[model samples]
Target: MKNTLSPSFSRRSFIKTSALAGGGMLIGFNLFQACKPEAKPPVDISQLNFNDFNAFIKIADNGMVTIFSPNPEIGQGVKTSMPMIIAEELDVSWDNVHVVQGALDTKNFTRQVAGGSQSIRFGWESLRQTGATARQMLINAAAAKWGVDASSCKTENGTIINANGDKLSYGEVVKEAAALEVPENVTLKDPKDFNIIGTDASNVDIDKIITGKPLFGLDYKEEGMAYAVVLRPPAFGKKLESYDDAATKAISGVQDVVRFGDKVAVLAKDTWTAMKGKKALEATWTSDSKLENTEAHDKILTDLLNGKEFKTMRADGDVKKAFAAADQVIERTYESPFLPHNCMEPMNFFADVTEEKVRLVGPIQTPAGTARRVAELLEREAEDVSVEMTRMGGGFGRRLYGDFALEAAEISKLAKRPVKVVYSREDDMTAGIYRPSIKYRISASVKDGKITGYHLKEASINSNMYGLIPNFFPAGAIENYQVDVAAYDSKITTGAWRAPYTNFLSFAEQSFFDELAEILEVDRIKLRLDLLQKVKGTTDERIQYSPERLENVIKVAVEKSGWGNAKEGVYQGFSAYYCHNTHVAEVAEVELENDVPVVKKVTCIVDCGIVVNPLGAKNQIEGGVIDGVGHAMYGDLSFKDGEPQSKNFDKYRLIRINETPIVETHFIENGLSPTGLGEPTLPPAGAAVANAIKAAKGIRLYKQPFIKHMKAKAPLG
Candidate 1:
């Protein structure tokens, strides 16, 4: 595949070059251009002496290159892949290039977030420009020395060669390149000429990660730092009324107990002592709102879906008329329970707050926003606070909230010393920001064996789906389409979890389409292909998905999975979805054992444009698929009187190694800019499994944690 899009350099992007203190060349460039009108051109590189750009590439006198990646890394492989983009355009040898995580600089960097799986997508052009511009400067420097036109010089493996067959190492021209002017524009390599990209590369930190290095947040420590454990309200809709920490202070190794807001933190010399101190403290809580339960939530959501009040997100045609004229109508409701992030490393952060400055170190997904929030909480300037990011064991949107970081800062300020706040597995699960429980009611009016009218109503806890989601998929496929949303705001905190609303929505919609296919007496894959054909060349600007790309992935999945030709006793399910700027399709193969459906394999096909690193890309795809399968099969979180019923793995169920299926991954090698892969592969797994189960056993599941339904069936043995 070859990329057809031409690289367009932003007029506002500026580059600066300087000499390193140890005799090296440093090139810094801003990948994001300012939104304002074009500013004056940057000063000549000969006069610049500071490093103020968003990303940097430093070449040592020994010809070794170090590229700084300026994004939060949450195990999505941006730390390894982002630098590949820069190194690819720099024309540097992969063996000599080093990658490092850059600190948060709000003024210099933009979109340093890690949630959207967009690190590579958004940085593709600017990062390439940064490297290409530097390569041009080096070529110009060598050309000047050789007394030849810059066009006559070519670079290969970090060496510049002129028409005369003479070569000079990049180290030989480092000083001269540092003196040249920053090029306003540079030509990028065509996709066909890519050497470093579209190839397998090992993770930059794999050696350290495998050898038990101190790379995660929990491994961070500082001299004189106190370990703190906080006791929060036991349940939602409750507040701290009073507390007595006399017993906590009496425990050995206990330093002090400090109260901030509605929570109390027990600071001690070590984590065990802090935990012991927290357990010894006596506290009383009072409920300010009705105690919520899973049953109550279900009732409320169902009521909201049945009610008349709803915010119409998107309405294309007269759905009422279409429904009235239909020969048959199909309606089904899909429900899911709240879910905790369950990050492998729990939540922990180290903070040192003094009168002059505040320092924070943690494995956070949103460093810039967290820094700003922390500064605001402490009534200090944002610039006065600095954040250092560590590699996270697992984020899955859990690390996006900095409540743990905030608690560390508050405790450090009150204790008059540095402190690290750590959460027990119970604290992490019970008091965590959760994926809101939701119910989706979908209805379609059929006439002449075709879906004529489609209506989808969503009721969730707290927030609703993003405004643009209604424009995806079926919105354009059906002429009479309508989407409405309602929410029941609760005291329980809820926010982004992996793919957000689409995670469950994909399963619901995809399963509904499967059922729809059964009623229409049509092939499941053919139904989706025909609907996508209706969305081709749509002029609707609000539609964010590409029908052509989706169709391609679906076709690839069908071909790779051998959709209709599985071996005897093997049943298959298919699902396709578009989210996070990527299109994905999955086929799940299941086998029956004693009347229970067991997933055996999953085939995933993705259209995420160019693959930066095949090795890392496959890791993400397989991980996403397995995660999706596990959550859909056995993951569930219930509540009783506003308290989570499952806080630890003892009661909570996670997919074990024995239960995991073999995942076969494939990608459509389109030459377009890459899209996110971390999340796009997850949303479709649930539906694929559900559909496969339905094929294996003549039963349909309309709720999550499909295990419950599977258990209800009588065993054939």
Candidate 2:
């Protein structure tokens, strides 16, 4: 069966057209072109003009096709996969396609942000249309030349073939295609006929990344650009009172010291000098609010949970009545500490601000929004600012906020010269914007050996879970289900980190489910299957997960992991979750050595719809699993007097290479449009390992950094 492009293009909606000076064609589709009336084609074929399109495809006389990807590249492989989508419909050989990053152009592009792993999901259809439109136009041109019906001509690897054996390369017909009217309808290839989509393709930037070819933000440099390092307040609740840079002025390579609002910056010829000058300056700080500590945070969150000030996120049925009639009630509390993004390339941005315009170049997840913010801060029109995005070392939700870029813009405006702000490891760690410490209290009611009611309460430092998360798993499966949220506002800063709320919440809920299975004396896998069976035909539109897809992944994980069939000395744990529009299931295998449980391997099953670039998809799944397991085992961040306690890797703990377990990944291909893959596989990893440890050693763990609990239970020699 074949599928035609939907919505049928409007006559007023045309692919913005242009022609290369060297006799080639340029065709593109603006995401918002449907809203505007199409302009008439230019009379001059050699100089056709269109400036409104965002994503573009250019055919060169040398048979090369260039694709412009309009989303930020945050190590999520969009730079590679997006172009593949376009090339698949373009009917071009993969070897002749080249990918380039498109600059920030809010006027032409839509959804230039990269957070939430939605770049591919949002751009899939539009990108395919861009290619299919270009290919159709090329075929029309060749058909006109051969005096045959356009439908009778077919394209194969950048060449158009007529039914009578006449042929023309794309480059040869591009000139005539530029003068043809944009087709109102174009046919899209069936998934079964796809050659470049389902097949594996290496990352477009793999060679540059491996060869260290100045691809990351930290590698960006400009002539006569001054390096600046800012000195922020030591604690979250404190503000700078005064600063004296008399000694800093004497340092070699030092240019100037400036202050902006509550922070001071030292500009020098190089990053090392800027850092050295920053250390030499003296500063005083004053408290703007009460200093907070980890102990205080714990008490505040616990009080919030016990208080009656929670806002109900979702309520499915009469939870009170269900709980009252239940024969048994089970409850537990889970705690997780704050975490840092810890990107391999620390925070950095380059800004060149002047009277007329502002230029920014760096690794930013939200390029369009950041440019707007810079314009607002500088009191300039949005059109006066431009942003260029570089490949990021890692984002993990850290680069979503543009605070670093703002600092660079402010400093550059003050100095009247281009400036690049760099952060040392300690600066990156202590400057705040961390994952909020969170606590989850879950309660479930059991009646006649079956679950009846489910209630969950979330308490965090600054913000609560997003509004849509409560409608995820278990919302439709359980009849009497309720979700509540509470928060404590603090001077400490916090934002999204990796999977956000679900990272810890999944562990809490999944671990609690394991306890429920134990109490009911039912097979854990069967218990989940039974729950999913109840939601087969749910009418709730608010429910965000697919029961059928989730069940399939769970079953696949069970079979691949050989659940309940591990060899001697090996125990297994299972967890299944859905988030970021993807369904994932994970199983952890554990073994005990000298009374210490060690995780040996993890089997992960994922259903993220169509797999674009299998090699890149596997990397995302494996990386997410390792990050989730490592953070659950050893990651922790504490605060003392409103200041982060761990300033560097020496004080903070991460998963060591030797401790990392083998990760086995499996994907369920349903041939649907691709969903997010970067963060979906991460949320279930912690719970799988925690449950496995419980089976291996008969201990239930509720706190993160599971190593702490293991050490407390260890016996003296």
Candidate 3:
């Protein structure tokens, strides 16, 4: 069935009206939508592009329907689930629909992004109302042409039917609808009447993924495009001093060797030639060896714990007095090191630049930001620059930084030719932004075997959503709560890595809670439940978490896993956290052999407000658990003198199929507006696994990559 355009209430419209009613562009909330035609036009599938057209619906002359997604598709299955929302309201057969990727037009696309798991949730209301409104307009046109009451006509399977048994195909009625005025507001279907939504829709791009179709940024190729490789500095803030391009120019297929900014680019006929030319060139780098090495970095972090001047993130009541009055105080320190993204495809971009216009195509998370920045750097108007987004091998927050896109645009402009900058696996690992290293110092007071107060101080490179989110932690919870965060700025660049600070914070907070439970001689589950009970209804100045949702996820997890009464020989640990509007609880089961902890199983319970696509949601949770476990046990990025220590997979290890853990996922059933799933589920696995290690062996694992030091600890038995 061909899906038609509709008129409905949009949050964008409401926000725009409110903004206008107040003043001008105060919040920079620009509304992007499909252009309203002077006279209605039929939905043409092939006319879809990233320019000024947002193809919410495309009806072929043959009646086949297509939905264009403005967001990038990584492994997340957004390519399948978002279309389901439109199909539901359009009342079309799923078998007749096709999904496509969106491009880099800020005026046409709806905030092109696949991160934060907002693809389905953000588009849910807009797409549904669009489809429903379009269907009504078509039915009205058909009824008017047949000289029958619109109430007597029903639309089903792309056809209009009357009570008199007369029928007309949607294709035959398109002309009349094209001439009709779209209604002001179209009624939406109730949740109970949904057919295509709330179902497990298979990923529309799965076949392409499995068969290795050309769908990723790495696979993108433009005519007359030559691959370029940049020779970056060995250390952060270091710049190129000089380079001898004799050998590179001597090589066959090597083109002009141009210097752009801090590095020289080796332009060649293909990726292999560019790489070969880059390796053959001799370049000198001026470095500051005074930069903190791995050992020095650790010492600085450890010393911060002793300092008296730490920034207060959260504080309530009197923490010093509470500690003084307590009969017992238990304190511990936890540490986590930097980690690389290790995306499978590496970083790549295709850029074509000229005096009049420039075109950029790649796997980028922020198309609008890239366009704005590129136009600024090129000294051109924003409209002259067009971005085409492709599927990323993986995002994990690295793509949002726009480093690769900027490099590609600069190189193409300098080379004055179409260029595709391809980063090798070595380049990707060594030159990418890393998850910041952190130190967590947690202290809790236990009076008469009951917890009284808690204090947590975290120090790390600040790459968190500090400015983006209104508040880092909810204002309510512990009465004498104290959270102090210290930002250590360095020459080393940092960016978001997976769930950001939540990954390390969860590990530290949940592990500390486990220790507190032991000190108080109370059940861990009961302690958390008690804390939730105390903070649930309490008031705070800012927005606090909903106690009911917090308790619900924990309750479901403990009950399903038989938390306190599990079978002997199997040790379990639990951790729960909230991020990006989603709540997740994870339980890890593990066994220690020769003091090395191996995760045997993981059970995850998620409350993402609403479940958009059941299968896709499960995939994200399961993948997050595995990814987190792998990173905590094996991932590490250290530096020697000022240079990165590990450059390839041989030096850095990864979790394989044989080492995979059995992951079980469950979703809290509800019709609430959906939240995010991509990053929230990832933050709890490390903390859960660390807690399980403590449960198995009466020892505390306070640092990341636990295997490195676990062998010297006590046995599980």
TM-score of 3: 0.90
Measured against the true structure, the TM-scores of the candidates, in listed sequence, are 0.93, 0.94, 0.90
For TM-score, the strongest prediction is 2
lDDT of 3 by residue, 570-666 (tens): 7898998777778788899987656566799988999986675788888888889999899888888898766788999999878877777898988
lDDT of 2 by residue, 1-717 (tens): 655664354323433221110011111222122123343322322243322222467776545677776677888877777778878988999776666677876544667777786777766777777788788888998999989999999999999999988889987888778667778677888999999997887676665666566778999999999999999999998999999999999999999998999999999999999999999999999986679999999999999989999999999888899999999989999999999999999999999998888999999988878998998999999999999888888988889999999999999999999999999999999997888899889999989999999999988898785322798888888899999999998888889999876899999989999989999999888899999999889888898899999999999999999999999999898999999899999999988877777789999999999997898899999999999999998899999998899999999998888888899999998888888898988899999999999998888989998987667776512
Predicted structure 2, TM vs. truth: 0.94
| TM-score ranking of the models | 2, 1, 3
Q: Which ten residues in a row are the worst by lDDT in model 3? A: 21-30
Tell me the spans in candidate 3 whose CA falls farther than 4 Å from its real position.
Answer: 1-55, 148-154, 162-166, 462-475, 539-541, 712-717
Compute the lDDT of residue 315 as modeled in candidate 3: 74
Q: Please give the lDDT score at residue 623 for candidate 1.
A: 92
- Candidate 2 C-alpha error for residue 298, in Å: 0.4
| Alpha carbon deviation, residue 263, candidate 3 (Å) | 0.8
What are the lDDT figures for the candidates, one per model?
A: 0.84, 0.84, 0.73
Which candidate do you rate higher for TM-score, 1 or 3? 1
